[model samples]
Every structure is written in structure tokens, then in C-alpha cells.
Target: MGEKHRSRWVETLVLLVRNPMAVASSLVLLVLVIVGVFGDVLAPYGYNEQFVGDQLESPSGSHWFGTDDFGRDVFSRVLLGAEVSLRVGAVAVGISLVAGVLIGLLAGYYGRWIDDALMRFMDMLFAFPALLMAIAVLAILGRGETNAMVAIGIVYTPIFARVTRASVLTVREEVFIRASRASGAGDFRIIFRHVLPNAAPPIIVQTTISLAFAILSEAALSFIGLGTQPPDPSWGRMLSEGRGFIEQAWWMALFPGLAIFVTVLAFNVLGDALRDVLDPRQRSALSGKGAAR
Candidate 1:
């Protein structure tokens, strides 16, 4: 089993590195992480520092991106915005992943009344539009970055729950699971030790995709004054601020918007690559096709 797992991971790594899209996306994501971590060091000016004479200045040597309406460096703000976006996405996804996986495990393992009830509740949540549901939660919780994270987490929970439940249901009927049950293994042991590991691929893929959407959701919330507030540089808020002066100062909207677009695209592409790489059926099919080739 250990050898099998090792070989499986090896195959996945091989496939991932060999894929051009995956490699490129990984590099982009890597750069995003680097920027998020060292933004302060890399940025010439503070994110909120107001330049006396540079308000609405176009991209130039001192400010590669440009200056915003407040004379603050657009490059600095965009650099730091990566941290805000990534932090929100990570926390939001963490919240959903934990809650959703637990709910899914419980629902799948103890299918019947529990499954029906849990699934129905998730369905109710899923029925609402993702952004609308998030907005409603924010309305109730009041406005702020923390609240936005909570709202986004809540909105995405149903999706993760549904994905995890389907994966668990598929794993539940496997020969090894039945064998483990027959051997008097506890439910917790079987579920955690065997079931969850086997069911993780789809969940991981879902997580990556969820992160992309989470970033977008955070940006949208910030755009509407529901997320990262004043003095705190946010790409969404930057966009909101830039739209008014778009005619005269288009760089304000363009740079931050491009950041959001590129980051989301990277995550989505990585998710697609992981999905293709992680599936055993897909891996076998690829091998067969290669042999035929």
C-alpha cells in the first residue's frame, strides 16, 4: 500500500510537471505567493503613502504602475493587495473545507436520516446565488473583511459539502471499505484512515477552484465596501476608486483588475490540471493512450 501510494504520487508529479499549462500556472501562483510575502520589501513606497506631486500620475520610472487619486503608489497597493486577497481566500476556503468535509463525512458514513437532513440543508444553502448568499450573510453579520471572509466561507460551504459527499459515497462501497468493516474496525478509523484519503482528489481539486472564486468574491465584496476597508489597500476597493476617474486615470482600474484576472486564471488552470492528474481512471487512460502512441 505504501509503495502503491508512492508510485501514484510519482505519477501525479510527473504528469503535473510535464503539462505546460500546469507548469505555467504554478509559476504564476508561485510569484503571487512571493509578492504576497515580500511585498513591503519589493515595493518602493508604502501602500498608503501619499505622494505630494504624483496624484494620478501615469506609469513611469518611480511608479511603474502609476499613482492613484490620493497620490499613493498603485504598484505598492497592488503589491500589498495580493496579501489581502490571498489571506481572505485561504481563510475562507479553510473555513468551508473543514466544515464541509466534516459534514460530508458524517452524512456519507451514516447515510439515512442524517444524510437526508444534511443534504437537504446543504441544498437549501446551494439554492441561493453564491454572491447573493454572501451578501445576505454580510448584511446580517455587518460589514468588514472578517465578515466578508465568513460570508464567502458560508456561501462556498455547500459546494464543498456536495463534492465531498459525492466522493465519500463513491468510496463507501469499495471492497477495502467493506473488508475493513468486516474486520471490526471502528467507523472513525475506517472513515479517516481509508475513506477520506481515497476521496481526497476531487476535494483537493474543488478546493483549488474554490480559492479562485473566493478571491473574486472577496474583490467583489471589497468593491462594494463590505470587505477590507480604508487605509487597507484592496484590489476591489482600488477598482471602485478608479472607476470614477477611469476617463482621466485609467491605470487605477487597469493594473488591479489585471492582477485579479491573472491570479484567478492561474488558480483555475491549476485546478483543471490537478483534476486531470489526480484521477486514477484518467491516469490509466493516459498510460494506455501513450502505449498506443
Candidate 2:
């Protein structure tokens, strides 16, 4: 079956399942995602509803994780904020993944004018610092979650494109690929079935890492007032507002910061694990070492 065949591509999943830290982090992220997706039902209080008497209240039975300056439940806002973070992360990475992989495939596989032109364009795009590039896009487009996602996607495309192109170049010269061409397989079929399968590992790894970057970029943009605006419950805006009261209302900032940290760390760790599993060189080295021992 297609599902079973696809499952075999990730032998890394077995190794990841064995890693306690990865498992724990993955569990935490899963819980957060569930809360984010169903926050309306899971959160006890409305994200923006004010509890006048509970303003800046410390953790208590009635108000957990304390209350913000406006007496809004920090717990509720954080849950709602997760929705924004995850949405931006998923959507932005998806956009970059598609655009980057297409560009990278054409450039690396075809070579000649296509490769040179595409790579040079990527070089120019890569020159701008991510924050500045995002700012420029947001400035022209005005501010909103959708616009912010676009900005983040633009910033991340280079990462996926470069990795994909390198993988494609490597795979294109492999004997299997040469044989596929010698058999008179169409260019499209060769590229899709032979080249892409081999090229996908690095691209997938980059996608996981890019998700983290996208989340961070969204947070930064929100912090600067260019992202998910007022009462929308984004972690960056929460951190920005909480900065003024950090000494007095530390929970407001602490929880969101921790959420971002742990989420990014989980993705990075998973990416590294996937890289180890996916790389043939690494697998061969491990096998060789095992034999020697």
C-alpha cells in the first residue's frame, strides 16, 4: 500500500521513539498543539475576557498562571497564542517548502542557464537580513497575520531552496539516476521518482527547522507591532507587553518565552535526529563502526 511504502522512508521514527528527551518534548508539543487547536473549549476563560478583581493576580485556584494587566487570564491567552504560533509556523514553512523545492529542483537538475540564474537570484534574496527583509515586505504590504506569514515565508525560502538544490545535484550523478535516464524514462518521471526521493531527506529536515524559524519570525514581527495585532493573543505581543511589567508580573512573560523555547528546541532536536537517520554517509559510518567493534 502507498501508506506502508511511505512509512518506510522514515526509519528515523523508530530511533526518535527510543529517545526519551525527544519523546518528552514531543509529548509536550502535542499537548500544546491540542490546546491551541481547541483552545476555545479547553481554556476555562475567554481569551480576552477580563476578570476585574483578578488583575495581576498570582496563580490561584480561581485564576491559574495569574492575570495580565487587564485581568485577562494568562493561561487562556497563552493557549490562544499557541494557535497563532502554530498556524504561522505550519503555513509559512509550507509555502517556503513548495516554492523552494521547485526552484531548487529546476536549478540543480537542469543546470546551464537555469541553474546560474536561479542560484544568482537566491544569492540576491539571501543578502538581506531576515528581520530587515521581513520588515521591508510588511512595510509595503501593511500588517496582518497573512502578510506576516508571507514575510516569514520569503525569509525562509532560501534555506529550503539551497538544501534541496544541493541534494538534487548530489543525487543527479548517482548511477541509479544515470541508469534511469539510460532506460529512456521521461525527464519528468526521472526527476520525480528517482531524483526527488533521494533529494527529499534534506528538504524535509530543512522544513522542520524552518518551522521553528517561522514561529520565531512571527513572534518578532508581533513584538514589533507588525504581526497579530491587538487582543489577538500572539506570544510575541504578549512578551512585548509583559516586558514593561517583567519585575512585577513575571508569569506573563515567563510562560510564553518558555513555550517558544521548548517548541523550537523540540523541532531542532528532531531535525538533527532525522538528519542522522536520513544521511547514507552517517548510516554507513555507524554500520562500519559496528562491524569494527
Candidate 3:
């Protein structure tokens, strides 16, 4: 089982790497992760340290990205902000993934009343636009990074639930699932052992896509003063601060905006590549063409 899983992953990796866009996106994402992890070490100056004399300095040999209105190093702040953005995405996604998967598995396996009840609840959440719902949640929960994370997770949960339930519904109809039930497997055993593994690919692709959204959501929240309070470096907050200085100091907003754009694009591209590589239809089509040739 382990060997088969490993081989499957290897095959997916091979297919993913074969796409130039995927390979490039993967490298960009890897660099972002490295920067996020070692940002403090990589940054030349402290994120919040003020250089009053050099305030609002344009990009030069000394300041790669320039200084902000507060004389803080924009480059350092952007580097540190990478850590915050990545953390928000990861934590929010982790919350949604676990809750969504469990709800989806139960709803798909049980069906009937259980499915109706759970899906209706998810539907209620879906009624609101994601950003609006996140904003409403943040409004009620007060303001902070933790609150933003929770709000983002809540906002995205329905998306994951819907995706997971769809995947589970198909997987539950598979022969192995029926066999597992016939062999006297318990509900937990059948759901975890048979249903989850088969349903995982789409869920993983959804997760990658969700991460991009999560990052965007966090940025939006922070831009509105609902996330990552002052003194903390956040891309959204930086953009908010830079709005006034756009005429004089474009670097203040440009660097952080570019960071957000690149990071989100990388995740989106990676997600699309994953879907192409992992979807059985794509694989079957490729195999059919190969055989015909």
C-alpha cells in the first residue's frame, strides 16, 4: 500500500513537472516558501526599524524596494509580510480542510436526511459572497489576525465541503467501497480507508486553489483594518498605507502588490496543473491517444 502510494505520487510529480508552467510555478512557490521561512534572516533590516533620515527613499543600491513613509524598510516589511500571508493561508486552509472533509465524508456516506441537513447548512453559508461573509464575520469577531484566520476559514469552508462531498459521492459508488461494506467494514473504516484515499485528489486540488483565495481574503481583510493590526507587516496593510503615497512613493505599494500577485498566481497555476495531472479523464485521454498512436 505504501509503495503504491509512493509510486502514484511519483507519477503525479512526473506529470506535473512535464508542464513548463507547472514547473515554473512550483519553483516560484518554492522560493516564496523559502523566503517565508527565512525572511528574518534574509531581510537586511528589521521589519519595523525606522531610518528617519532615509524616510521615503526610492529604490537604490542601499534600499532594494525603498523605504516607507514611516522610514521603515519596505523590502524587509515585504519579506516579513510573506511569513504572515503564508501563515494565514495555511492556518485558514487547515481549519477548512479538516472540517470540510469530515462534513463531506459523513454527508456523502450517509446520504438522505443527513446529507440534506448538512448540505443545507453549507448552502446557508454559500448564500453570502465569500468576501462579504468574511467581512461580516470579522465585524462580529472584532479585529485581529486570529479572527481574520477564523473568518477566512469559515468563508472557505463551504467551498471545500462542496468539493469534498462531490468527490466523496463519486468515490462512494466505486466497487471497492461496496466491497469494503460487504466485507463488514465499519463506517469509520470504510470512510477513511476506502472513501478518503480515492476522493483525495480533487480535494487536494481544491485545497491548493483555496490557499490562493485564503491569501487574497486575508489581504482584503487587512486592507480594511480587520486583520493583522499595526506594528505587524501585512501586504494588505502595506497597500493600505501606501495608498496615500502612491503619487510620490510607488514602491511602497508596488512591491507588496507584486508579492501578492506573484504568490497568488503561483498557487493558481500550481492548482490548475495539479487538476490536469490528477484528473482521471486527462490521464485516460492521454493514454488513449498513446495507444492509438
Candidate 4:
């Protein structure tokens, strides 16, 4: 079983490598992860260190991405901000994944009243626009990175729940699931052992997509002053601070905006690639189309 699983992963990797966009996206995400992990070491100066004579300096040989209004090194701050942005994305997605998967499993397996109840609750959450719901949650929870993470997690939970439940519903109807039940498997065993494994591909794809949204959501929250507080370098906060200086010092906004754009785009592209790679129908359709041509 382990060998088979490894072979399957190898096959997936082979397919993924054949797609240039996926390879590029994967490399970009890899670089971002490395930057996030080693941000402190990579940053030339302390994120908050001020250069008295270098306030609002334009990009040059000395000041790579330029300095901000407070004489802080924008490059250093952007590098450090990668850690904060990635942390928010990961933690928030982790929260949503756990709650969403469990809720979806129970709802899908049990069906009837349980499904109705849980789905209705998810619907209540889904009724609000994600950003608005996140804002409302932040407003009630008060302001901070932790609060923002929780809010974003809560905001995204319904989306994952819906996706997981949809995947589970299809998997539950499979022959293996029925056979497991006929063979005297317990509800927990059937759900986890049979249904979940089959349903996981879509969930995995959604997770990558959700990470991009989570990062974007955190940035939006920070831009509006509900996320990472001052003295901490956040890409969103940097954008907010740099807005006023857009006329004179474009680098302040440009660098952070570019960081956000590139990271989000990489995740999105990777997710799309994974969706194509994981879906047998998509693969077969492409193959058939190629053969016909």
C-alpha cells in the first residue's frame, strides 16, 4: 500500500512537471516559503531599524527597494513581512481545514437531519460576504494579528465545509464506501478510512486555493488597521503607510503590492495545476483531445 501510494505521488509529480505553469508556480511558491522561513537572516537590516539620513530614499545600489517614510528599509520590512503573511495564511487555513473537514464528514456521512442542521449553519455563515464577515468578526474580537487570523479562519470555514461536503457526498456513494458498511465497518471507520481518502483530492486543491485567499484577506484586514499592529512589518500595513507617499516614493507601495500579487498568483496557479493533475476526468479529457487532434 505504501509503495502504491509512493508510485501514485511519483505519477502526480511527473504530470505536474510536464506543465510549465505548474513548474513555474511551484518554484515561485518554493522561493516564497524559503523567504518566509529565513526572512530574518535574509533581511539586510532590522525590519524596524531607521536610517536617519535615508528617509524616503528611492531605489539605488545601497537601498535595494528603497526606504519608507519612517526611514525604515522597505526591502527588509517586505522580507520580514513574508513571515507574517505566510503565518496568517497557514494558521487561518489550518483552523478552517480542521473544522471544515470534521463538519463536512459528519454532515455527509450522517445525511438527513444532521446534514440539514450543519449545512444550514454553514449557510448562515456563507450569507455574509467573506470580507464583510471577517470585518465584523474583527470588530467584535478587537484588533490584533491573532484576532485577524481567527476572523479570517472563521470567514473561510464555510467555504471549506461546502467543498468538503460536496466531495464527501460523491465519495460516500462509491462502491467501496457501501462495501465498508456491509463489512461491518463502524461509522467512524467508514467515514475516515473510505470516504475521506477518496474525497481528499478536491480538499487538497481547495486548501492551496484557500491559502491564497487567506493571505489576501489578512492583507485587506491589515490595510484597514484590523490586522498586524504597528512596529510589526506586514505587507498590507506597508501598503497602507505607503499610500500617502505614492506620488513621491512609489517603491513603498509597489514592492509590497508586487509581493502580494506574486504570492497570490503563484498559489492560484498551483491550485489550478493540482486540480488538473488530480482529476482523472480532466486528464482523460486532455488526452482524448490531444489524440483526436
Number of the top lDDT candidate: 1
Candidate 1: misplaced stretches above 4 Å?
289-293
lDDT scores of the candidates, listed in order: 0.93, 0.86, 0.92, 0.92
Which digits, one per residue and each the tens of the lDDT, describe model 1 over residues 1-293? 66887888888888888789999999999999999999999888898899987899999998999899889999999999999999999999999999999999999888999999999999999999999999999999999999999999999999989998999999999999999999999999999999999889999999999999999999999999999998898999999999999999999999999999999999999999999888888877766765676
> How well is each residue in 34-142 modelled by candidate 3, as lDDT tens digits?
9999999999999889997998999988899999988999999999999999999999999999988899988988999999999999999989999999989988999
lDDT of 3 at 146: 98
- Residue 138 in candidate 4 has what lDDT? 88
Residue 93 C-alpha lDDT in model 3 = 96
Model 4: per-residue lDDT, tens digit, 102-216? 9998898889999999999999999999999999998899999999999999998988899889999888988878888899999989887778877898999999999999999
Among the numbered candidates, top TM-score falls to 1
Estimated TM-score for each candidate: 0.97, 0.93, 0.96, 0.96
Ranking by lDDT: 1, 4, 3, 2
Q: Residue 147 CA error for candidate 3 (Å)?
A: 0.6
Better of 2 and 4 by TM-score: 4
Off by over 4 Å in 3: 1-4, 286-293
TM-score, cand. 4:
0.96
Which ten-residue region of model 3 has the weakest summed lDDT?
284-293
